[model samples]
Target: MDQCITEVKPIKGFYKLSMKQRMGFGAGDLAQNLIYQTVSMYLLIFYTNVYGISAASAGIMFLIVRIVDVIWDPVVGAFVDKNSPRMGKYRSYLLLGGIPLTGFAILCFWNGFSGSLTYAYITYIGLSMLYTLVNVPYGALNASLTRDTDEVTKLTSTRMFMANIGGLAVGYGVPLVVKYFSPDGKINSKDSAEAWFVTMLIYALVGLVLLFFCFSQTKERVIMDEKDTENVKVSDLWQEFKHNRPLRILAFFFITAFSMMAIGNSAGSYYMIYNVNAPDMLPYFMALGSIPAFIFMPLIPAIKRAIGKKQMFYVFLGIAILGMIMLYVISTNEALKGNTWLVLSAQFIKSTGVIVATGYMWALVPEVISYGEYKTGKRISGIVNALTGIFYKAGMALGGIVPGLVLAYVAFDKDNVATQSDMAEKGILWLVAVIPAILLLLAMYVISKYELDDATIDKINREIESRVNY
Candidate 1:
């Protein structure tokens, strides 16, 4: 491992990365979203309808996995910060963990152990833990790339763009692929177990190839000293969270933002299938969630320059809320309920806001890391990401918990393929629209508390670099 750690002189001026480097960095995220987004969006539905688990049971499992993450995330973070593999400081895990992550991800969708909670627990938990091993390091790798705020912003934009591409693939592609492979040519049918398993296997392998591409392309430029790494500990994660105000604000914002996305994503298939009575249109509806990112993410740096970060959040989040309202209104009206175009239009509007707002928040992660380093003279990127990961997973837990519980509460009948009860449809609507909108409202408030503007973050980054150079 030591032989693989390349020693480079300390960087002084702005480290402008090549387009290839930026794209390479972004590919890691794209890979992750390819596999993880499928899990986030479709896993619950799989567990319930296809895997024969009760919604309530799946919901409880989701919560338990998050609790495990609460413990596991910090461990991975601290270990990664404290140890540098030969491949790279943080980038090494793209392979080390990525391999197992791919395997577990594939195993997760396997119905070989049909209706077995233990199989679900083992595969899901393994996948989650391995994801942390890869994700925490990948996040730290971002901060380790360069200190230039503008460069980070550009990098983030590219990353989000690629991530949305992955989302698009999963959103539209998964159902298409699954349905194509389904014995009866219906994706949502209970008999499509083999299709789900095969689809996940293909997706997971593709993800592994992408991860390897990311690993081959990325190189860590800025990193902590070996001596400093020795000081890293799991407890330092909590300590940093306690003192880092910007991190705290960002962490809380992560909770709300991810919760909004998770709830909406998890409910999307149900929304189209049950609420809108358009099972065939489910792919288009879900794909719209990623379409806006491509259209708007390229303009992020300019958008931030025009309106400022806080105002950007306010405007986009408001747009998202409006779209959610539109969705709810149209879905409930007898006249508009079955209008596919109107529904797609609403999804487009809502996703446009969501893509920009949540997409841009990632740029802030590096900013907060710089702020922490400025204040404490330590850049524990791994630990910081872990803290944020915990909160975001907390949000994801809600995504799992809320939908399953709501479905169970509404007595959603998985056995009834023809139509859901009115109560079940309403619950699905709440998951897709009302609940997520409320979470977005809270996200708006939480982001309002973030204090690290670009100028402030730049100053902090410069100061930290000067200290490193001295």
Candidate 2:
């Protein structure tokens, strides 16, 4: 019986990844984040204050771009699963999508167009759509790597660590580089246009290099049978969502978590510059956003094993809420206001919780993919990831809408860059602290709905492998 079980392993892949393979896989997320995180963190402020568009216009454009993604993401997902590319099924996009993605990403930050709403719409929409091409494929690639749940956790940890490194680069390094290029050494002002363009050009080139490296490192192993591939349709994404209970729960969590992160990240620059009256502190504030990942992400496997995954999530998420509350108190209190150490401490705490909770969520992606396959014999990773992508964007849509509408409600004046009214400052505070904390509460509830725990997913995976071998 032991010999029979031992001989019954899948022929192609589902082996543990090498350290090199893990780093190479992680490099992909780091590369994408360099461009994507920059957009998430800075693009709105760039549009309103530097590029000459109104906050409301920029906000609406953000929404429109995401709406296009809602359509485009499913097509990309279905197309990827339906056909095998010559370069590779999923990794091919590292070259095919990365080149054009880099181009539009840099163009999104260019001031040459100078606030022309048409040009803004064209470039941004192009960037978001092409991003789907890379993002959908890349997401599917994670599931294709291996079937070992422990390996998935390590891979996700490494990926999030690299991702935060990219975030740090955008948060801290971009500003420093832009300052060097700015004649007056200011990143937020109109005159810093040349600086912004040059900085983006450099980052985009580096991202392109990382994407090529990622392409070389990754090899797709677990995929649908060729016969299964031909049958995949765009509608399969919806079908998979309806059938896979864990996937459905994970999808809602994506919306809530991404919405929470986006709202908070988008609000950071404005908070530091306006409410805190410390533009120079912006980079440091943002850098802290990713710093906690380095400190705590490595311990996640142990943490989950010790406390169990669900309990681990509850702890970190609860920590995040506590941090947000700390931020609100520090920012609003007269005695604590303008105390740099206190502000930075609160940010560190908030980020610590947010980073760990969100980072672990990616590991669950492969589990749900396994669950889908366990129920329906087809491991349609692309379609499943696409479903997650759409919901992820839905959350981001809220992120984009809330900040603009709130700022507009408070009558935030773009012309008055030097200072905003107290009402506008209060609105920025809500974006940074209160609203996000509310979403975090929703996330906790959504997580409670998730059904796949480690042992159950492992059993599902082993059963599927046994079927393949038989």
TM-score of each: 0.97, 0.97
Ten contiguous residues with the weakest lDDT in model 2: 4-13
lDDT of 1 by residue, 79-131 (tens): 99999889988999999999999999999999999899999999999999999
Candidate 2's TM-score reads 0.97
Name the lDDT of candidate 2: 0.90
Question: Which TM-score value belongs to model 1?
Answer: 0.97
Find the 10 residues in a row with the least total lDDT in model 1.
Answer: 5-14
* lDDT of each candidate versus the true structure: 0.91, 0.90
State the lDDT of candidate 2 residue by residue for 343-449, as single tens digits: 88999999999999999999999999999999999888889889999999999988987888888889988877668999999999999999999999999999998
